[model samples]
Target: MKKLNESLEVERIYTVLEERIEQELEERIELGCWMYCKEFCIMYS
Candidate 1:
């Protein structure tokens, strides 16, 4: 029982960390795209 509980706790923490990493990647991609678009617009107009 103790071992099973420990495994579950580890899994939960891993899942949370994975989710946060994914969220950060998505935010960075969005920011990069926005910056690129702004630069393109300034260059054209």
Candidate 2:
């Protein structure tokens, strides 16, 4: 029972970390896209 509880706790922590990583990746991608668009507009205009 104790082992099961420990495993559950670990899984929960891992899930939270994974979510955080995904959010950070999404934010970075969005920032990259915005920067690219800004640069493209400047070059074209």
Per-residue lDDT tens digits for candidate 1, residues 1-45, read: 999999999999999999999999999999999999999999999
Question: Against the hidden reference, what TM-scores do the models get?
Answer: 0.87, 0.93
- How high is the CA lDDT of each candidate model? 1.00, 1.00
What is the lDDT for 19 in model 2? 100
Best by TM-score: 2
Off by over 4 Å in 1: none
Q: Summing lDDT over every window of 10 consecutive residues in candidate 1, give the lowest-scoring window.
A: 32-41
Whole-model lDDT for model 1 versus the true structure? 1.00
TM-score of 1: 0.87
